[model samples]
Target: MDIDKLSIKKKRVMIYFIEAARRLMASEGVRALSIRGIAEIAGYNSATLYNYFDDLQHLTLFASMSYLRDYVSALSGNLKPPMSSLQRYRVIYETFDHFAFRSPEIFYNMFFGRQSAKLPEVVVQYYALFPEELKEHFPSVRKMLTQGDMYRRDEPIVEELVRDGFVRPENASPLSAVVPRLNQTYLHELVNGKDISPEEQHRRFIAVFDYLLETAK
Candidate 1:
């Protein structure tokens, strides 16, 4: 009967619905989701779901945002806070490794599922939610000024690397943008029906991830 108790219950219910939405999206795609489907998944009546979320689109975005938040956190993984820019780079790769290793399905969906994810707002928001595509990596080139990390000091050299096209901006998704194709082709060839070990898949993905990072570094 207490208002606080009621609020807590509502929050818990919303969390349930968010998770349900993700599974439903992955299994059936966003087009198949409806109030009835989500309600069934959440073990609630259709009208009950409306109490916590405005509508199906709102619910879809909430679920997508939750996934994105978790992803950003994962990118930081086990690193101490206040990571150096180079360390930050490692964290990003570490996040890539974690996702590639543990939940490639969700990781695959995060990018490939965008068209089917069905929340235009969520899609638009997440296009930029992509951290590697962010412009922040340009300034980070300065981190090379540090003695032994990724970058090197000499201004003319850095400039020549930049000028001769050796250095690509970090925001550039030279490899990432093509991941859908790579997955369709390379990764599928390696896995799909094969009895590939998880370690092998992890190694393959890390190798690809490292290859992309090598140029930017």
Candidate 2:
């Protein structure tokens, strides 16, 4: 559908629904987001949301993508280049961690709201929402994941390391298997409501993530 052809009032209603969903996620967590709840908050009837979104998950995921835009926005004017692949890799996580800490609710919703840790279809849809300027903050491997299937999701990063001479060709499979585990650990810790300081969080992240990098060599 050409959303551009949508009437201004219709566009405004869609925005209201999406924003209402976001407000709910921020205040009451992802589980609180229901079509009726959103409609109530947005001053619309329950059935009205169907005109804007296909289902509750569609609106919820759409709302979640705004947090990603915020994450990308936070990285604006922040990345310093001339770093190694490993360094760039660290920056990516650091940038994400910083944003996640600052906006715990949204990041938790984005990373841990779904039952399956991976949101392949939603991730693919959200990637298209990123503006061109923020596109550079995305790692090459992330681009690969969004474009391709999630099986062997870490393969591209390992291949990049091999291309950079950071990992030997033969060690690719082992390294790929282990490197993504660090992310799993980090996300698990972040959403589990662990009572750790931001400093401590970074410390733990560096310890495990750096160890993975070391083992990759």
Candidate 3:
């Protein structure tokens, strides 16, 4: 549903559910989320949640995006002027690595989980419902955030590198394809692994990401 077209009361109800899910996620973490738990916290029954959301994963995705506020806010500071495309790309991913590693399961579910395909619509719906999170970013950064598909989001960056001669034209496609997958692999490990700290995970991801960039050049 187009969130803007929803009746005011319906939007309010949806916000209640989304905010409730966010509180649950913040307090107990992603894996602990349950429809009944969210509904109870929102002061509604589980069936009412279905009226506002497609399913548990749908609601979860909406709730998960609150975690990205830090990432979007930090990106503007890292992406200053007088930087090469390669440098800008590094800064963007490094900033992402810092935050994503902190909440691997949330990031993983948002981008790679079963409901991943609905991400584009969910992003539009999410920001429409909570425009404040979308407001702090610069125009370009905001564009990046709204790009729901991870591969499509990174393509333009790789294309810019190719245009600037930092990356070979022939290498652009492969780099774009491989980079997200590599990030996904590491993210999967971080989400499921028992002992690794976020700091270590970030370092390891950057090492591999930097190595891939070097080889792509």
Candidate 4:
């Protein structure tokens, strides 16, 4: 549907359904999400939901995009200048850590749940709703929107580390590799129902990142 063509009533109903999905995911986890369940919460018949959304996946994706505001908010504040690329990289992970650990269910569904959709598509869709000011914080989105593939801003950061002699040229590949390992570890722990204290979480992330830095050198 052309969002511009949506009537006021339709827009309001869509918002309610998205909000209902958010509440259900927050309260019960992603496993509890269903078209019928969300429709019941929104006080509409299940079939009525199809008027606004393509399917349950479409609704879930829309609901998940709501949290990107927080991600952009967290990232935008910490980008003050004189910061190194390495420092910026750390800040990105730190912000993501706080976001994902706080809402693992939503994170999983938004990201890891559907193997069907690509990350670049999800990123484009989420940021389409981003306010203009917030959109300024994400340069990668422009490339992803144009190219229709995941764009890693960190790849250049790792390259810079090698060029600056912070990382040995031969070890540059693993520096990039380490970040996704850290991400996977976080998801693994969350999926296994293991909890780490905030302090430990901070310590572990820093430890792993530091190890990569040291080994790269």
Q: Which runs in model 3 stand beyond 4 Å of their true positions?
A: 132-151
> Sorted by lDDT, highest first, which candidate order results?
3, 4, 2, 1
Best-to-worst TM-score order: 3, 4, 2, 1
Model 4: colliding residue pairs:
none
In model 3, what are the clashing residue pairs, if there are any?
none
| Candidate 2, 71-109: lDDT as tens digits | 555543354567776666667677777776655555655
lDDT by residue (tens digit), candidate 1, 119-196: 334433333333343334333332321123111112333343344455565534444344335443433443344566
RMSD of 2: 5.3
Question: How much lDDT does each candidate structure score?
Answer: 0.51, 0.66, 0.83, 0.68
Listing every candidate in turn, what is its Cα RMSD in Å to the true structure after a full C-alpha superposition?
11.3, 5.3, 2.3, 4.4
Candidate closest to the true structure, highest TM-score? 3
What lDDT, from 0 to 1, does candidate 3 have?
Answer: 0.83
Estimate, for each residue in 159-185, the C-alpha lDDT of model 4 and write its tens digit. Answer: 877777788888888778767667757
TM-score of 3: 0.88
How many steric clashes does model 3 contain? 0
Off by over 4 Å in 4: 1-14, 26-31, 43-58, 115-153
